[model samples]
Target: MSTRPHLLYLAWGFPPAAKSCVYRKLATANSFARAGWDVTVVTLTEDAWIREQGVDRSLLALVDPRIRVVRLPLSREDIETDIRRFSEDRALRPRTWLKRHYQQNVSHFPEATFGGWRDELVASVRRVYDERPADLLLTSGVPYTFFAPALDLFERNGLPYVLDYRDAWAIDILRDRPAFRPDSPAGLYEARLISHATEAWFVNGAIRDAYADIYPDRAQDFHVVRNGSDVAIGTDKIPMRQPGPDEPLTFGYLGTVSFSAGLTRAVCEGWRIAREANDVLRRSRLEFRGHMGVGANRGASAQAVAIAEYAKHGVSYGGPVAKADTAAVYEAWDALLLILPGGRYVTSGKVYDYVSTGLPIMSVHEWDHAAAEILSDYPLWVRNDGVEAEDVAEAFLQATKVVQGATVEDRLTARRHAEQYERYAQLRPAVERLTTRFAPGLDHVEPVGDRAPKTGEDVHRETSVPGPHAKGERVVLALTSPPSEAVRRSVALLRESGAHVELIGPDSVLEELRGLADEVITLQRATAPVKVSPSTSVTRFTPRWASVVARNLGRRHIIGPYVRVVGRSAGWWLSARRSPPAMQALKDATVLASLDDSATYLIWNASRLNTRAPARAGIGATLEELGLTRI
Candidate 1:
């Protein structure tokens, strides 16, 4: 047998998932392989990813050929949007069937949707371990179910493993709240998993602190392994473009357009307002290049609809950009729009990519975002205080000025600032530390051949020429029901700002608010409740009793119905589906402001429709959650 130390990495969202976590997964595997360890990565199959988030074949190219990747036949049932794939029972009552499926899964494993994969994952790890005993096992998790297999391997063979939490399990990032109570099953599982883990890696200091606070004893074991940019794959040679006075500045947003609808609207409206206020902004274009949404909605999400509607206002969606084409995409843009949601817990993977580009960055997120910490020293960063249209508009103007005034020296300064955050730089030390501490024999092994040059190095140079800037103000669409005082004030404010505001509501309401808005659209109220399939329903206590009795009597027939009832209740509680007109308003609105609870709820639902854990909140609470005091 070879004397090389073996490492088995378990990452559910590895290559081809096209998910946000794939970059870190790719980097970790490659880092281990280069460190002279025999690396084996276990991940879900491409077909499984296709049925869920879809696959990106381009990502496969980024994986090091020397590292072995084993594809598991695992897929998520919840994200399956194809109705044709549903069984007869599931088709009859989709919500109920799904609930029961989740219940069955969680009963076996702590993770709800992915709990069912416990056996397969355990078997896969065991098989790999039997083939060649692994010196180390590293598991990255969103589906914390990976812990079960890792724990199994440890208990069975005394193998040491590290827990890599890309996102925390017990903490909710969006709400900044504890996702599970300390006494909950998930909480218990996390405690047990961490108790035996050699080390726990987090994406940022904030997340590490969160875990540290929860488990004070294991605080020293936690480490921050930030998601750094891959210079070899992208961000190698810096390209600088300076727009002339008459030329239109191209502001580009790269990565998935998966933020809240309110955030998206704010950025679009800010661009609109900036264009109206500044000649330079009016002639500019903001292009979004990434996967629009997940599952069946894909590019046809509300975000895509809004982008299509704003086509006249210099907003365009160029679809998903390939991993190899990332450099080319950055070269095409004059500046970058960094739009992300969540407060301290959310440090997007794209921020490193943006910083490495050495291009001017216009941030469209809360001031409290972790990305702010990283970009604090960046030379050409234009940050917004809040998500309000006016603040965002001001940021757009500032970014335009920065891009116009950018010099070669300024670009070089920005690139130099990002040098510390390259993928290899971040991973090499972490891998070296792990080897030295745990597998000391592997410490002397150098990385297999010279790796690609880091960014800011003189290699594969490209010259960029200045482009022309385009100009014009954007149109605004406003939707109101009874026209409350808040709505009236908001409408008046938009009109005073010189926006071409259009109103859509009841005829009487529109007539009452006619002078406040530029155009009025009258909508008729529905006489009957809108009947949508998979209708929301309440679960009765009888089901709980029935479940208990069924368990005692060993009657699976009773168990299925009880589980379905639980699922139906959960579906009703979590569903954020909206009416046609409300969706239309979201699609057309340059900026969405809600005065009343109903309007706010509608907008909030639309914004969080695709989110994994969509929460219901009033306008004030939703705005507060987004780090905005007002819109």
Candidate 2:
């Protein structure tokens, strides 16, 4: 037997991945190692991270040396940085090609983009398992795709697994609904995977409630292991200095760059409120640090858009804050902005960080967010219950008053409130519990994770499931989307009439619109394609789309005839010869006019929209005019 109980930690975005999830993973692994367990993390290789978020070993500073990380040979080909490796087939129908390939990849497992890594992940875990037995396997998922390897291992070894879902697999916390259909393939995967786990961990109580609602039967395994404040906080005994007569109030936001609807709207509105309401704050500067989004959207993501819009508000994004500089940055700030997304269940990892700082905090998220819960007793919080500019502005003004009036007692009080949330402190009990469970019947076994697990997974599922779809009629709209108002309102009335309205969306999308679809392919991005052979669908065309459609139309072999390709206009068309075949193929393709205008089109022509969205819908109508819908 191993000298110490061996705990297998599976997290794709481990330290050096440069993803936001890296911090949590690092902390969790380090926490396990600190708790006397031998932690073996299974993640992607160094080169693989290079093509994705790029590498940053700085996060490993706090990592335990004893913890072993197995970097598998896997790179997300979707984010492949090597342009020279593109093939002719991959070039022509780039959009369609990736879509089709993505589907097939998921078919091999349950995830889309990373699904192809399934066999390798399983092989890696199994290889480790064979070498030395695992007492517990804790799998963290943001790339919910990481669950497969763990689930596959359970099939053979029956090793108890843990699902460390930071956000959640189901329930769009923002809109608040089932993340996916209860019956969809993705939903099926979630049900089974979560059901068998020894523990299902969530970042907050809200997320825990959601899982319990979805999988009540396995309610016994649920846990609320919050994203805690780091225990290794700044060590200066010196009291935070007061603002100088000449210096302005410097407000700061640290960690991940984000423009999530809730985060963006709240912060900007609050900024507008602060700037306009307080003469002092109008001169105050807001600086944001940390990456916006990982993968392909590094600096140019929606978060970037928010920062750009707030540029005139004396807010500037100086870039991501270095881990070493975290404490000093908070010390420099006059106050902090805690802009977050999600309602009651959404308490970000940053909340603890913000709480630990002596700065006054102005909340620009929901009144119910878990972050709000953390700040409930905090003296400096000026919570903005609304996202509107007026309400946010008032909240900002209130924050200014708090900053100005703050006493040493106030700062000490804030720090005291946050003491328990220290990353290690928050994790201590759970770590002990995990250790005990893995080393079952140990006198050291402790009942930890104060939140109840009795409200399990199975109970959550049955009550949360939307009623069965109405009887279907032919010619109804096909959908496989996770519920969203855009889709819901589109088919609300139709669905009410028993028309088979399918919703095709990913589980990451919100689920409030669950009742709007007859059936949903809830775990896949709608933009993702299902592979189809070229010979399967005919290309006969007539009507308005004729000239454009006929020239580019071709039958897809996998996703079926209803699906068609539209060019991804990434950049202005390159000289066909200079461009890769896929870029050239985009030039030759008759993508719907609207699709040609999208961000994905950047590969083909970054300046223009794909133009095919409305065009495809239009083409369908035009075919009805010719009475030739199909070849």
Stretches > 4 Å off in candidate 1:
445-631
Compute the lDDT for candidate 2. Answer: 0.61
lDDT by residue (tens digit), candidate 1, 1-631: 7677888999888887777788888888888887888888988888787655456776787787888888888887766543334454654355567799999999989788899889888998799889888889999998888878889999999999999997799899978899999888888888889999999999899999999999999999999999987666556465565679678888999897779767787788888988998887787798988876554344445675566667799998776665666777787788989999898998989999889888999898878998988999999999887899899999988888898888878888898899888876777767998888766876575653434655434333333323211111122232334644433443454455455555545465567777776666554332222332465452456775555454445423543455366433222212212235434544555344333322332333333442322221222221222222110
* lDDT (Cα atoms) of all candidates against the true structure: 0.70, 0.61
Candidate 2: list runs displaced more than 4 Å. Answer: 233-239, 244-247, 261-266, 269-273, 309-312, 440-631
Deviation from native of the Cα of residue 55 in model 2, angstroms: 4.0
Q: Ten residues in a row with the worst lDDT in model 1?
A: 622-631
Model 2 lowest lDDT segment of ten = 456-465
Give the distance in Å from residue 44's predicted Cα in candidate 1 to where it truly belongs: 1.0
Clashes of 2: 73
